[model samples]
Structure formats: structure tokens, C-alpha cells
Target: MFALKMNVLMIITIIMIMSFGIFGETISKTNSETKLIADLLAGYHPKVAPTDNGPVQVKMGFDMSYFDFIDEPKELAIAHGFVYRGWNDHRLQWNEADYNGTRRVNLDRNTVWVPHIQAANSAKVTELLESQVLVFSTGRVRFYQSLQIEFLCDMDLTYFPYDKQSCNIEFGSSLYTTEHINLTASPNRGTNGSRVNSAKDFQITTLDVQRSEKSFRFIAPYSFVDVTYTIGLKRVSSVYRAKLVVPSVLTSFLILATFLLPTASKEKITFCSNMFLCLLLLIAFLHTTVTSTVETVLGQLLAFSLFVDFFATIMAVVSYNIKNRGTSILTRKDYGIMLQDTTMDGDSGMRAEKTLSTKFAWLRYIDVISFIGFSIVFVIGLAAILNQRE
Candidate 1:
């Protein structure tokens, strides 16, 4: 009897311990925390035409890149982390093929493309692989749907103490057009071999030209969080014309004014030189004003300014020399006659006239060159800008 009682007590104690152990294991499994280890990458696909009784289709793809995932040591074990999914938004304007065999543009769904994972696993907890996904839409879509694709990743909390990795998402689309949409290519769909005009849907509205970025640090391990980045570019061709006409006219007039000034007033001649300096400053200011708007084409404007400054300075030098070395016409007309009675004074007048003639001759040539050069530059630059507009 004593031996049997001892055996029964030992069995009861063993059962209780086994029950508690199993309960503890279940609690630990249920409470294991997780972290999201994947980033969003997405883009849209080209539209297709319908054939036979089959529906036409469009496809968009999203690539999910993951990091520090739960180490599924078993090669065949189902590891869960991410999925690919999308949403359909609305139908846009569309038309059918015409008599010429060209179909009208028809976009069926103006929907946003979203990402959800269908299946996922890690080859190695340390290894990162891009899950390439292809999402399809029917050809009934017309006018092409304007859509935004999204990606969401879920992390497994079972793996803790690992840092999340940074991620990037980029997208591009192919062009889709029907012949009816493009009159030049009648009877055929408007599709270009060049990627630029392939899909009418991926064309962004001007309002959507700006890009956006978002980022945040995950403070809690095994917690689910998401970050997004958006990129957009504008399709624009603007004609830029630096108004050389205004500055050129101002500069030309200043150069012309130099000729109107008296030759004898050292100050008057220097004033023409000063006008040239002012032109240089104005030209410099104009170039600087446009530098930010048109960076690549500024070399021509600089060259133009330098050309004006060089000739203006030279004219200033010539004028200064004439004024200092030659007799003033007024001085010669009044003083020469007064001095004519005396041999010494008359000889001086003759010498003065000769010096004035020699010194001012270059002035005439300078005037001609400057006027022609300024006009040429102004007209050429204006003409080039006009041609570009065409």
C-alpha cells in the first residue's frame, strides 16, 4: 500500500509541472514582439490593346526590399514579413477604334496603385532581396488612369534587437497612346517607340511636379512603422531671352554720347569714360539677375559685356589724349588770330592744330566700330532667342 501511494503522488506532481510549462510556452509565443524590415519601391506599367475575346490589360510593379528579417533557418519554412496589393480608383475618358483602325484613348480606372505582400521569406536574416511584383489591369482602361502606388510592409516581432535599414522607392512608366489620340499616326494606336510618349496615364499634372520625402526613427523594437518618399519632375520647355535690346540700346546711346561731348574739357571726355563704366555696371547687373534662371547660357552675355567695356575704355583713352595733347578748337579760333600778329604765337597755333588733328582721328574710327559691334551683338542675340522659340 505504501509503495502504491508514493507512485501516485509522483505522477500527480509530474502532471502539474507539465501543465505549467506548456502554459508558459504559449504565453511567450503569443507576446513575442516584431519589427518591420522592408522598404517600399513602386512604378506603373504600360497599357495594352485588346485582342480576340480577351480583355486588354495594364500592369504596374512594386519592388519590396527587406532587411534584418526573422532568420528562417529552415529553407522551406514560410516566413511572413511583406505583401503586394493595389486598389482601383475610377474610370477616365476613353474611346474605341475608328474606321481607320485607330482606337480612341480609353482609361478605365483612375485608380491609385497600392502594395501588399502575397508571400515573403528571408534566405538569410542578413541577406536582403528585392521582391519584384507585377500588378495587372484590364485593357478596358481608357484615357489611362492617373494613379498613385503605395507600399506597406509588416514586420515580425519574433526577431528583436536588430536595427531597421534605410530604404528608397523610385518609379517610372512607359508611354501608351492610340492612333486616334495622335492624328498623325492614324489607323494605328498612338504609341511611340521612345519611352517619353508611351503611356498617357503616367504624365503628371503640373501641380504634381514637386517631390516629397518623409522619414522617422523607430524607437520601439518589434514595432510596425512606415516611411515614404515621392519624386516628381515637370515636363516644361520655356523660352529664355535675356533682353539685350534694352541694355544694348542703353550702352549704344552712351557710346554715342561720348562723341557729342567737347574734346577740350578733360572732365567732359572723362565723363564719356564714366558713362562706359556705368554701362559695364549695368551689363554686369543684368547678367547677374539672369544667372539663376539660365545658368548654362551666360557665357555669351559675359562676352558681350566684355566687348562693350573694352571699346569704351579705348575711346576714353583716345578722348583723354586728344583733350590733353591737342589745342581746343575754341582756343585755336580765338587765340590763334590774336597771336597771328606775332611770329612766335602763330607758329604755336599751327603746331597745336597739327597735334589736334593727329590725336582726334582715332575717335572717328572708334565711334564707327563701337556702333556696329553693339548693333551686331544685340541683333544676333535677339534673333537667336526668337529662333529658339520657333
Candidate 2:
């Protein structure tokens, strides 16, 4: 019985030690966590007056190089870069000495309140990688978010192929009024301005960038501050020059070259007809791809080729008629000359035939002159078209 009592005493001692060990482990885990929970609550809920508070200045910027392909069908521009915005709030600032110089803490997005700023014409948000909130020793709170977006651009393709376009990306708050958030084009301030550095080291790709501060109103009486980035994209038309311009010029030259053929050669008409058909085919192909609402330089060149082909066809037909209807002999009196009215000699008929043929020789000269004239016009017009943007 003494041995059993001793065993019971040992069992109680073991149980008490195990309980104390578990309790200490639990305290170690909860002690730091409880403090963090308190910090999260205190950091997010800033003690600002509920009324329409003073302006919250926001600075905004993005890298220019990430402008990828343009989506014409959807009127969207795909861009990828660091997009960060932050504002200062004194209520969330801290005294560094209280936390042993550990004033900043990263929090989940759900735990924080972010300005409801949105891309007015955005289509897709491909990725939302991360959101960071940091508090500084001076009571400054800065927030950051990195994302990829496909935003809308009112694409004007009037100069397509050779067109320059202006595209805009606008961002403004929906819930907050101007009184609560008077935004600035500069979207970062104080602490965030130094750390993220997202907008600072960006290179815009083939765009003339301009930052503007604007204001717009919704159903509410107040106006929201909006920042806009306007970019101009100039077309590089080397492909178009090869596909449209080169062929157009060659086809036009062929139309004029038909003038060198004999007036009545059926081969000349056949060749012009085939060449003209090729031009029409080219125009058809251009129409398929060049669906811009406004006509482009390439379109003009296509139209010009059609006109030249029409004129060449007319000349070809005229040549056939002139050759078929041999020129009629004219009397000497009709040639502004006087001839004696004596017995006609046998040579008269042959002489008259030769004279009539010589008069119609002017047909060849007309063809040559018209060809040169039209070709000169085409070349001059071409130089003007290509140099438009230069």
C-alpha cells in the first residue's frame, strides 16, 4: 500500500509538469500574436474625423516600356508594370521609440482600407500580385499594389498604316469626393516615394507621354480628381510600303508603259487588262485589312491606281479605233494650200495617201505625252504622301 501511494504521487507530479509545459508553449505563441493583432487594428483604423476631410494628395506613375500589343478589335492596350499610389495620414503614424525602431508592419489587403480608385476604361485585370501597407515612425501610412492591366484606348485609326494615335489611361476614385481626395498627378509621397520606386525608373515605349491632372463628376454634386496619361503612337509603315506602296507604284508604271506598244497591237490591250486586274485585286486585299473608319495614304494610292488604270483602258480602246479606221485622204485645199485644178496624175493618189498617214502619226505623240504627264503626277503625289509624317 505504501508503494502504490508512492506511484500515485509520482503520477501527479508528471501530470502537473506536463500541464505547465503545455501552458507555457501556449503563452509563448499567443503573447507576440496578441500584440500584432493589436497593432493591425490600431494601424488600419485611423482616427480621422468622419466628415469630408481634407484633401488626400495622391501621386501616380508607371513604366512606359511595358506597352505591349494593341487590341484593335477590343480597343484595349495591354500594359505591365509597377503601379503604386500612396497618401499620407498622420493618424496612423507611430513613435519609433515605442516599438524599438520596428515601426513598420506588412498587412494583408483585406485588413486595410484602400482608395477606391479605378481605371475608367479597363477591361481585364490579369494579375493582382501583392498589396503592402507600411507605417513609419512619423505617423505616415503608405500603401502599394502591383498589377497588370488591359485598359481601353479610344483608338482613332484614321491614319492606320500611316496613322498616329493618341491613347489615354484615366484613374479616379468612385466613392471618395474631391473634398476627401484631391488627387495629384504625382501619386506617391514621403516613405513610399523612396521604397517602391516603381514609377521612377520606367522607359516609355514609342510613345510621347504627357501627364495631366483633370476633374470629372459623377451623380454626386462633387467632382473627383482624375489623372490622365496621354500617349501618342506613330505607325511604322515599312511593311505597308512593301505590300501596298511598292506594288501600287509598279502597277501604275505598267499602265503607262503600255503606251510604248504599237497602236493596234492586241498584245498591248491584253497586257494592260491583266495589269489593271492585278490592281483591282490589290485594292481588294487592302480593303480586307485596312478596315479603319478613315481612309489612309495607302487607300489613296489604291484609288489613284484605279484612276490610272481606267485612263489607260480608255487610251487602249482609242488606239484600237484609230488604227482600225485608217485616216482619210485630205485635198490640198483642206491642208491650207492651193493646188492647180488640172488633169489628176497617177502619183496624186499615192501622195495623198502618204500625207493622210503622216497626219494621223500625231496619235503616237499624244500617247507618249499623256503617259509622261500622268507618270509625273503620280511620282510627285507619291513623295507628298510618304513625307506626311516627316
| Top candidate by TM-score | 2
lDDT (Cα atoms) of all candidates against the true structure? 0.35, 0.62
Q: Which residue pairs clash within candidate 2? A: 58-187, 59-186, 59-187, 59-188, 60-186, 60-187, 64-204, 93-139, 159-163
TM-score to native of every candidate shown: 0.33, 0.69
Which residue window of length 10 is worst by lDDT in model 2? 189-198
Q: Give the TM-score of candidate 2.
A: 0.69
Kindly list the per-residue Cα lDDT of model 1 for residues 1-390, writing each as its tens digit. 999999999999999999999998666433321100000112222242222233212222222221111121211211112222222222211122211222322122322222221111222222133332222222122122122222322322111111121212322211212211111111212112122221121221211111222222542222221222221212122211225434544554455455455544465556656665765665565445333312322334434555665655566676666655544344535545532335456567677566556657676676666667676776665454333211
Off by more than 4 A, model 1: 1-113, 116-170, 173-249, 256-299, 326-355, 358-362, 385-388
What C-alpha lDDT does candidate 2 achieve relative to the native structure?
0.62
